[model samples]
Target chain A: MVKISDEEIRKMVIARLEITPSKRKIIIGGAGAFTKKELIEKIKQHDPIGQKIIEVHLNYLRSFKKQQFWG
Target chain B: MIITRPNHDFATKYLFRWSQTVITLAKKRNILVIDLKGKRASRVELTKSVRKNTADFIFINGHGNDDLVTGYNNQILVQFNDNEKLFRGRIVYARSCRSAAKLGKSCVKKGTRAYLGYTDDFIFYSDAASKFLGPSNLIAKTLLIGETAGQADQKAKDAYARTIQRFENSSVSEKDRELIPYLQWNMEKQVCLGNKNARLKI
Candidate 1:
């Protein structure tokens, strides 16, 4: 089972969200890149590739607030 | 602009809705919009449309990875290698995954005026009920509104900032407010390559 670390989440999620504009990688796409779950599993199996897990979930979470506003 | 929107899955359903929004907005400006929506959004159609050279901009929404973007039911629409030349002499904004990583650059090298997308996965949050109608729509709309690619990109970033502010200051639960980080991640991941100076002709 693949698991993302807390610090990794902090950097990719927390820092990414907190900063208005953050520096990021600029490499273009390659053929058949891994999905969210696939990337996680790969990372779990072989501790290579420092790729971030953000690419895995295209829009993983879903929510609707009670304010009746469009989420 | 040529847009490909495949609406087979949950995420794609939202993207298809967003693509329609783009169509409506583009039509308002009297822009000739060629949309490969739903079932029509196949690789064959995409290649055929490009061969016709009928448009100078492309805005695609669907599932993709580093070098490939799929259409209906995750059918491989366009991937790396010789296919990127399909974008030559045009501006492209792929709302897919890491198409920008290599495909975006290759498109530029092959003569695409500008390419806008994430060097990684292009993620966004949407209401499950309302689907894809979210701030994610801002970037595509801003790009097709006849603004410079760079300017449109800036506007998209600004819109993201505004949305972030909205979520942060809202009284919603921490669970409901969980989208801020993902929103921020998309902003950071979204990238522009090629001539930053490129823009669509109105």
Candidate 2:
């Protein structure tokens, strides 16, 4: 099995979105909805890559709804 | 042209206007416009119409998040099912905010060449609508002719910048000018592209 790092998962997400690192980092870190653990689990189940991308996006949704967790 | 509007009054108006402008511009370039409206169409309908008709590019204008596009009555619009592979080889320009984030994996998995969308909440300013039309048209044209995602993005950004420049040059009233900067800032902030080289066409 190929081991994928959290950072690699992050990069894969960014690459898929066609966004730069600067933009990707901001969306993933500051958005605040995604927990690192939950994302890793989702990645493990649904994707070849890991879960960093989902984590960042969870944050984005949280920020958008102004909610603390996934709605 | 597949325009899906949930219940947002403002977004519906903006999409209507944008669709009108796109159709007019496309006509000038001799491009045919296929109108796909309403929320009842299934994924099969979308794929068959697009593939059989051979649309060069597909534009999905609707309210979307990172995961899915919602239809009227909170119906989720998805391009693929467990056994079906759709949305292949098309450049999808999603007007919904933040719809492009983390959606790349799904798009890639479905075999779509690339996806473009906002990374944050977007305010549909009137001037921004006019400004976005040209760039959007150019991007569609390039994609239809087989330009790579990266090339299409550059062309689209250049068009967006030109639109900003024109907005600055226009002699609008002071009230509008003050709002223009805010609108411009939002436009700059929200615009994002993903998967520059994702080649979906087989």
Candidate 3:
């Protein structure tokens, strides 16, 4: 299998997030609710929250690879 | 038992509402509860309540960072060095973000019996509030029933695992499957510090 880069995984994460309903909101700590569009913008900027989102998605993918479903 | 519910914003509103389950569970057990809701969830009020009541369990629901946990209007309630000492000899379960990393440690170092919290952001969606709160609420439920702090933490993590498994099932919807990453993040971030054997006086 060809190795996938972080940027590729990041784009895939963004694409996955695109399917999220606009009305649905993701609340992160005290920052309150963030719309999908706003989260996409954050991902593009690669800010702290964006990096966190990327990490969350990547970790979820890695879990399947490692067969570590629960910790 | 003392619980702080700060209903100031969208995030806190959900916390405030979900924390009622904990309060109800405690009340059902006939435990003496000193609930500080809304404006009463302030620094001065929390100090006074802790000093006077000496409640064995402190359940705080609010937004927080590594160094401090806030209450109503994001008012600083208990900070790392400022008021963490107030929790000495007590078990605290802060349903806030990142407090376990710093403040929880300080509380333990200051003589707190146990501290259960998340080391990073506690993320959840509005529609799936119960899914997140269920595991969190389990900590208090198990503790109130004579389980040790460590046992309670493990039970909560087990609950999180079960919930995550359900969402990962092949028959589950895509929308629900999307919540898996956040749930796993929360499960990974949850941490238990201090004496795991610590139990509430009740």
Residues B118-201, model 3: lDDT tens digits? 999999988888888888899988999989999999998899898889988999998888898998889889988999999998
Candidate 2, residues B39-148, lDDT tens digits: the string is 54334455567767665456665565666554443345553243114556666776555566556346756776666656544443344355445565565556555567
Candidate with top TM-score is 3
TM-score (second chain) of model 2: 0.69
Give TM per candidate. Answer: 0.72, 0.55, 0.95
Q: Best-fitting candidate, measured by DockQ?
A: 3
Regions more than 4 Å wrong, model 3: A1-4
Per model, how many backbone clashes are there?
A: 10, 5, 0
Task: Kindly list the per-residue Cα lDDT of model 1 for residues B1-202, writing each as its tens digit.
Answer: 7889887766777667666777898888888878888888898999998898668888877777777777888888877885887888888888887778887887788888988888765544334212113445666677677678887677777776676567767685553355554565677678888887787776
True contacts kept of each: 0.02, 0.00, 0.77
Would you give me the overall lDDT of model 1? 0.65
Q: Give the winner by lDDT.
A: 3
Stretches of model 1 off by over 4 angstroms after superposition: A1-71, B128-133, B170-172
